[model samples]
Target: MADELKLLSTWFSPFGSRVKLALHLKGLSYEYVEEEDLMNKSQLLLESNPVHKKVPVLFHRGKALCESMVIVDYIEEAFADAGPPLLPSDPYERAVARFWVAFIETKLVEPWFKMLDGTRARAEMADGVKQMLAAVATLEGALAQCAKGRPFFGGDGVGYVDVALGGLLVWVRASEVLLGGVKFIDAARTPLLAAWADRLAALDAAKAALPDFGRVIKHAMMRRGAAAAALAQSN
Candidate 1:
């Protein structure tokens, strides 16, 4: 089974890394395929995820699953017999984990993209800053609720919720620099989120899945510059 799994991913994608970590945690040996060219996507990735045409597609026994969290959930279901169990059996617990994942994807990541687009347009920049601050505050509140005296989302052990949130930390922080100095997850301000990040980073699987923060930040800055140049050219 180890030789059969294949992962299609990009190095800097938080979404892609989440799927990678889940497969690793399940002790599944997969062929890692990095797709660096987004403009010229791989034929396999296109056919596998025609709707999204994105990275982090998982192929297990020739069946393809798209989307990071969905693929991770699929991996958990298929490889339930191996490694630490990521999702909770309890229905309520599973719901809660899914809720947080949704929150992060919608409220957290979406606003950052807005903040990125805000760079060239004065109106967008103003709105983006406002939205980003509000988004960060909401995350701080959610973190406070989840912290309930435990290190992870599952109280003691790392679970699906933790993995979902934890996977985005490296990319989020790297993106802050590109958003022109918006520090959303500051250790000094959002202490609980900061602590959670530290705890997650200490885990072996987290460290293995993460790319160097410095390189991610540099790549983000370059992406921002390219976007800005394109916008200018259009104007």
Candidate 2:
């Protein structure tokens, strides 16, 4: 069953990367269909994810799952007895793991949208930066507290929690260029987070699933440049 999984994702989306990492971690082979034009989204994407009309949709045996985290959860459940378990068996710890995922999406990813979309006003960008900083600081503190004695977020191994938070680090690192020369995972300010990122990147799954940061950055720059040119033409 795992052999027949199919993933629909955009190259630049951190959300998409999360599911890819999960699949790689489980040693699953599936079709990876990249969405080239977001504007003219494929019928599969719209049909698979009717609600969100978004990418990172996973198709398994003709069943579809939307939302990156939801897809990761599905992957975890599908291969639970076979691969490295994503969710801890303990219910209490599973809840904690889920909390961080929610925190990253609602608290961090949301602000990142504003920061990336150059259409945002100056004040909005400032507010977004402020919010992103606050969220990052909170995540840093929480990770430090959690890593008191161990390495990964799941004590000794990379689990759902680690994949949930750590998957975004690469994208965040790439987007540092957008933040006016501020890097997100500086060892000095975010030592634990930085180290954790290095550890995740070292993993075979993480390495395989690592997005092409350069290409994504180039795409972002092109978008920004086109937008700026349009604005200048309007003026």
Candidate number of the best lDDT: 2
- Per-residue CA lDDT of model 1 for 1-235, tens digit only, reads 8688998887767777788778767778889898767767779878988887877788889988887888878888888898888877899878877888788777766655565663457676667667766776776777666657788776677778777777777867776776667777788878877888888888888887877799877766667655332222110
Task: Give the residue spans of candidate 2 off by over 4 A.
Answer: 225-235
TM-score of each: 0.88, 0.91
Candidate 1 C-alpha error for residue 11, in Å: 0.8
Q: At residue 124, what lDDT does model 1 achieve?
A: 68
Candidate 1 yields a Cα-based lDDT of 0.73
lDDT of 2 by residue, 39-158 (tens): 677898778778767778888999998877888888888788667888888988888888887888788877866666677788987787778878888888878665565788777778
TM-score of 2: 0.91
RMSD of 1: 4.0
